[model samples]
Target: MAIEWKGIFPAFTTKFTAADELDLPLFGKNLQAQIAAGIDGVILGGSLGEASVITTAEKETLTKYAVEQVAGKIPVVMNIAEGATAEAIRQAKLAAAWGAKGLMLLPPMRYKSDERETAEYFKAVAASTELPIMIYNNPVDYKVEVTLAIFDQLQAYSNIQAVKESTRDVSNVTRMISRFGDRFSLLCGVDTLAMEEMILGANGWVGGLVCAFPAETVAIYKLTKAGRIAEALAIYRWFLPLLELDLHPKLVQYIKLAEQQAGLGSELVRAPRLALVGEERTRILKVIDSAIATRPVLPDYLSL
Candidate 1:
């Protein structure tokens, strides 16, 4: 089936056992929760999923695992973030071979390439694979902004179907809609600005917090799009604190912590990234606890 890049697509964090091994069963459980929550799709091996620390072989395994677990229920898009164009092409091919329905391709990792270099890198990968690609434009964390001019150069690739707009500028959503029209689907990648972008023109949300609160994420999208703005605003206001967690440098840890609180997954992270501790842990918990203590019950209107 052709995957629709037009709703909530959670960039899931990789689940690890205490020994730091891939916990495929735990991963499946979280994915099942996403399916039940009515998320539009799933993205594995993105930055939130510890892509830098994961091996290409592991990602291929994850792509296969997600495909099997989802069993064609929803599209599974694998993320490709490599330092070289050839490596990116190889990752894209590996994902396609392993049954991924789509690919979220990042710019050449490690080095900060100029716009021309970045466009070339994307073109090379797109030319090598038939899978639909969501070009991730996260300059804040990735140091690469796929600017409008760069996108203008890439619009010819029909396989380059979408843009994960995490430039942190809400106006970028409007700019893309104005320039590309229906040519490129815009996915809001910043959790904080998700509502704003969606209200403007984003076709979907490539989310982080959805891993923890999938239902609420989907509800927000559905409600807003259904012209139930007041209802969506209430949930968005309640969700704002947790959504802010996705914007942090240690978002993986924060999100894993949230996942544990929600009984969705473990907080165990790979080496070099430890569980939160000290005042940091206490500080984050204060916000989470308060939100939980007063968490709003979803109305029947959101049952969809």
Candidate 2:
């Protein structure tokens, strides 16, 4: 099946032992749990998984492992963006060659700083592969905006199928949908604005916090899709703290800790990216406790 980029796609975490090498066993297990929980797809090597710290070999291996583990149960989208065009192409080619269902494209780290430059950059990367690509409009961290002009131009490419809208601006999401008119599937990259964006017109969500609590994320999607707006809002209310955490500079550490506390994955981030400790660890644990307390109760899992 051609993977649809139109629903909850968990930007899953990278697991590690206390010693911190790639924990493929834990990684595969977590992927399985998310799939079984009813996620539309599994996103490997995304910010949620600390893709920036990992080497190309690690990304390649994880992409291969995740794709194989999903085994057509769900779409497996790998974050193939790099600071350099050559590296992005390398990751995308490797993931495509390995049978990943899709690629999540983040702009080059150099930051186009403007629309024409951004358009040119995306065009360059889009020309590199035939795999369906989801443009990651992560202006929150990237400082790069996916302006309407840029989206209109990029949509001309058949492969630029979806976008991870990281902007919190509602007008931006509404404007894009109005302009493109289903030409692009806008996935919520910012957790806080997900409900609002969906209310406006977003088709899906892709973010760091959802990986630690897949069932809750899936529940929100199911409820919303079924037209149960009140129920979805209640679930969304409980997820607010998590939405706030995504705004923090220490987001990766906090997200990994939540996964660890949930018995999902390790908070073991690679070096240069230090371990969460002192005040940061305490802060994250409190958030995890709250998420566990308010997280939706689901079948086949522990009660919230």
Model 1 per-residue lDDT at 1: 56
lDDT of 2 by residue, 150-236 (tens): 988997799899998987787778888778899898898888888888878899888677778788887787777667788888878
lDDT at position 42, candidate 1 = 94
Model 1 misplacement above 4 A: 301-304
Q: Per-prediction TM-score, please? A: 0.97, 0.93
**lDDT score of residue 89 within candidate 1:** 86
Per-residue C-alpha lDDT of model 1 across residues 61-128, encoded as one tens digit per residue: 78889999998999999998889888888888888889998999889889999999998999999999
Best by TM-score: 1
| CA lDDT scores, all candidates in order | 0.90, 0.80
TM-score of 2: 0.93
lDDT of 2: 0.80
Q: Which candidate is the best by lDDT?
A: 1
